[model samples]
Target: MKMDYVSSGIGKTDFLQLRKLYPLFVFSRVSWENRLDHLYIEYEFWTGKNSRNALFFRPSLKVYGRPIEKGSAEWLDPFLFQLGLIELISYWKATCSPEILIQAGSLAASQIKWWQKLYLKGLGEFFFRNGIERDYPGILHIECDSAKQFRPVEIFSLQGNLIPVGGGKDSFLTLEWMKEEKENNLCFLLNPIKAQWDTLRYFSYPLDQVIVVERQIDSLLLGLNKKGFLNGHTPFSALLAFLGTMLMALYKIKNYVASQESSANHPTVPSESINHQYSKSYEFERDFQKFLADSLCPSFSYFSLLRPLSEIQIARLISEIPGALSVFQSCNKNRHCGGWCGHCAKCLFSFLIFRPFVEAQKISGIFGSDLLEKQSLFSLFLSLCGKAEQRPFECLGTEEESLAAASLLWHKAKATGKKPPVLIEKLFSQYPHLLMTRNAIQATYDLVNTEHSLPKKFLSLLQKNVIKKALFDD
Candidate 1:
């Protein structure tokens, strides 16, 4: 928990040491350093930690040997370190037998850790052999901060704060909150393969000021004989802040903010993400916020602007906010296509939660179309119904909210006399696990009033109610 850089130089700040400790690193660099802003961020990685030697599943990793610069060393260093984990672990599974990687944080992170070895092994086999590569490249190209391509973090930090932007409802909500809160120290992120920038022109013009985390990590896997799918839901929230710390310290920024929702604090699915929201929960905001203060910077503070809200709550808020919707991005299947691949959980959940507020034109723009087919909605339905190793907790929503959205969609479907969402139909036909989820969602959601958004503070207060609902529902 406590790391002393001087005594544990190699343990705390040595890149070469970490690389040697883990090893599969092939390439690395500082992709964007906005000198004017004093933000320096490195795009780097780590080797395999081999925590799975005792199990049949092994996770291989790939990452850069450095950091990406957006602000200062204070802001950039830990940000890069955090980025390295998410970037490398994808390759880690591709190279090893790490099916269901427990990323120590993230919804998926929590679920995988609790699953049996047999389940993990099964997922590993299905993934590496099949290699289901999915990426939502809708936000990577927005113009970067107004500075040279490779500005140092020392400079970027002085320019502003590094904000790890998410292309989703949560972030869209945070942007408005932060803007309304009058915090100008902001820097945005554009991940590898995202198209959020092209769409930004549809909304605000100031987006060019955002700092991008251009990732080319896929190049490293070019020669590896093995392959595994990329894992999602790691503690990228905290990681980005650590990076902000490094870059800000090196360059001079003093604060960082993330868009993590308050609901993230509870398990993604009860018993699934229980203790691990720290990877993305408000718990991380609280803990890491203090960690940064005690061990690191006194002036530097890291917390989620959306920490008090739930994913559903944020989605609802984003619907009410105007320009924010135009620039937001969070689809995994199609980033460049200018449409939400209704199948991915992000699109599915967003469409469902906001169905009550946003109109067809607005919804169409969000997903690239007004027409959400039954199949798209069903994909999410199936996930929540329990199709894979984990349910789409992000999609599951609070019981009351979940039921509310389900009811709206349900009513709309019945009125049109359309077939039930695939998963629902399957359950009606007596599908095993499939039926259980349908019944659960129907019963569980009945009490949720999934209508309208709540103030961030109010949403936080409702978390206890959500937990009670999640546990009591079944």
Candidate 2:
């Protein structure tokens, strides 16, 4: 379809009216089906005039042996707009569409504010990476049918905790905590990969315990990217947040616990709002909770279980969980087959953080090779440590965490009168300031982050069940 609106650098006389001419995209329809005990969700999006696209479920959703009443789940009727809005942003931002027309469902005044914040701040990394300047077209003009509400389920009567897993150590640690309530702790995943399956199986969770959905993207959007329509990263976690709510309602689950951590708050670029993990940050979690409370069911709750902890702290906690050494995988590049390429930023960061908590041989064995011995990874390590020109755009812990891990490893080796790993020694030699004493090294391991949305009960659970005797208590 030809773009009817003026674009930047076009020197057109209609620049001022660009917002009006720009196509208004609407999330038009949401259809579903239950075949062979599987639920399938289909979405339709329209972009001004006659242009429209559709997305379907690649693999039908499975909620094994669970009772999901069609009428009760269909109450998701009103919230479909919330789910659609999240899905629409990915395609809308692709064209950098100036206006979004909502024809499918309603958005409250607070909903408008929440979405604007998500689109602008959540896409911070996308715009900066694509060289798109920050000029947000005003607040979304949300046009919907009417505000609708359905019968609310009793909040106290809800049964289980829906823990979303990504085959990472953070989720694994969350799993360990939720195990006390494991019978009532259900796992939620979108498009489960081999790594996810392996991790779940290693934890002895039966196939029936996990709920899986296959989210299909519109192929037309992929084609546009090939044809040079603007494209970059979309806030994927935001999409998951909405999809998670739908599944929670459908399956009659209450708590939506993701594994986002405190380290995600750091900006990817210095002095800028471009954080790769913006959707996973504590700010987004807090905003999402408020929006859920205001606009959705009173029975539902959403928050990250690992919000108060750091990557290093989580790594230390994961070390205590059995089978963690071999089953967990955090390398996004090789997540499909559960293999670590051992060259990417995620792999390097995981290697550094794990070094402080686990034995050298065990850590190397889990990764299938010693990452520290590979001199070729030095540059990648530097990128993670903030020595390079840019922070790796991948999801990683803060640079301070990386430096602290290196410092601890070096000092620990010195205290034991043993030579440190090649990477640790090289890091210490190059940046002498990273060389710390045993006392300072211990301080780095204690990550007490106060900026989290975890409730008092959840915080108490972590302290009594996981933290007190886990890391520093030793």
Candidate 3:
């Protein structure tokens, strides 16, 4: 009998049923080989003991402009093993199995707790969306059968910075800030897309200087998703953290500079911790740094370069860099199409953030239309402003930031003696109290959250280029 899982929706019953059917998910093995110019990795998993149905995934990475050296297996093995641990989450969510058996490597009690916290918090949105209530200390159990414990390697002689580019304004700004030392920095990209490449080209970075990792999902997992098995968002940035660490070790890079912003800390669901961008949050940044220091090399610096700035600040900075305005993109839905869809929450939020800084004509030209005039995106607008039940489950700024951007645009329109757009008019008419004053909006631009992991050198760089010049000078 074919189950109508979609119509019924996956709930506690479905969660329990799948767990009972597939009692155990095993992290069976991790194998990697350094080929001529690329390093190939394969991970194996099983639904249950003695089950013939096994899953295999192959993800390869290449570091150009350098020789491929198979680093010490002692350190490399653990890195690959940990990478498998994160990769398994995508497949494990299919059944939400009660226990995960680790046969490939071992973890200490503290390490087990660390992973549990990561999985639970990382999958918080997944549980909330599926209407599944998971309790702590018993939500998911991890058992390690192997006797081997991987220790941190004493690594030295690593130099240069590695920046992960996402083809967005944030990364573009990072590239701009690091332009002085661009030769020492390498752009890291996973599953290269046209937008990512476009951002690199706009920055005048050659392809040979980029580190590209090609990740492939197992077909069986997709088949399960199609068969109506439970599935939702996984912690992708968490996977990137591990993969970035592997590349750092493989290439002897000192820094893994990401472009995640402070706004990622806000939860999608207000008053709850179910953030779609949990892996990109500052909490994760701090936790991952500690884990790396404890389990890997302490000197391997991993931090977001734009951690201290807000989305509005990033947008303001990008607005000043006119060259990036055309090449960089943030709309996830329309990136492959090479333009803004202008309908999704991401597109709408981006438009709102940039509206105050860029001229109306230029904004319209970039997005192909005035997103503010689109009445269809009103609900998303309300959600982003915190008027709706929850913010759209996307990487967006806080509700206050959205309100500030909208308010700033509103005041600008009124001062210019021009009428506000449809959405803007609707916003003030319906919720007048939501409007913010110009001074209040400017406060967001000047504000800098003190909580960040940026080292002194990078912090000084941010202060000089962004804080002192970009935000205040304007």
Top TM-score hit: 3
In candidate 2, stretches whose alpha carbon ends up further than 4 angstroms from where it belongs are 1-22, 48-65, 136-156, 467-474
lDDT of 2 by residue, 214-300 (tens): 777777767655545556777888888877777777767778888898888888986777889999988888888777776767678
lDDT of the structure predicted as candidate 1: 0.44
- Measured over all alpha carbons after superposition, the RMSD of each candidate to the real structure, in angstroms, is 13.4, 4.5, 3.0
Candidate number achieving the greatest lDDT relative to the actual structure? 3
Error of 2 at 67 (Å): 4.0
Q: Per-residue CA lDDT of candidate 1, range 1-474, in tens?
A: 111122232234222332234433322323544444333333433235553422122222222222334333334433443344344444444333222222222222222232222122223322222333222121011111212121222232344444555555555554454453334444555453344554333334264445454433445444332221223233444445555565456435555666665445555435322323445645455555555554445566565555544555555556656665656667756765555676666676666677645665667666665434564465455454344455553423543454445444554555668764444444335543222233444453333333323335434544432432231222
Q: By lDDT, is 1 or 2 better?
A: 2
- Give candidate 1's error at residue 416 in angstroms: 12
Candidate 3 per-residue lDDT over residues 1-474, each given as its tens digit:
112265324343367677776788888788887777777788888875345754443433443435543454447887888888899888888888888999999998988899988999899898888877746335599999898889988777888898888888888899999999898988888887888999888878976678888888877777777767888999999999999898888778899999999999988875666889999999999999999999888889999999999998888888888667888888988867788998899999999998888888999999999999988889989998988887788888999999988887788778879998889889999999999877777787788989998899999999988753322223
Error of 2 at 164 (Å): 0.8
Off by over 4 Å in 1: 1-162, 180-183, 192-195, 198-208, 225-234, 268-278, 323-327, 360-379, 385-390, 393-400, 408-474
Worst 10 residues of 2 by lDDT: 53-62
Error of 3 at 29 (Å): 0.4
RMSD of 2: 4.5
Instruction: TM-score for candidate 3, please give it.
Output: 0.94
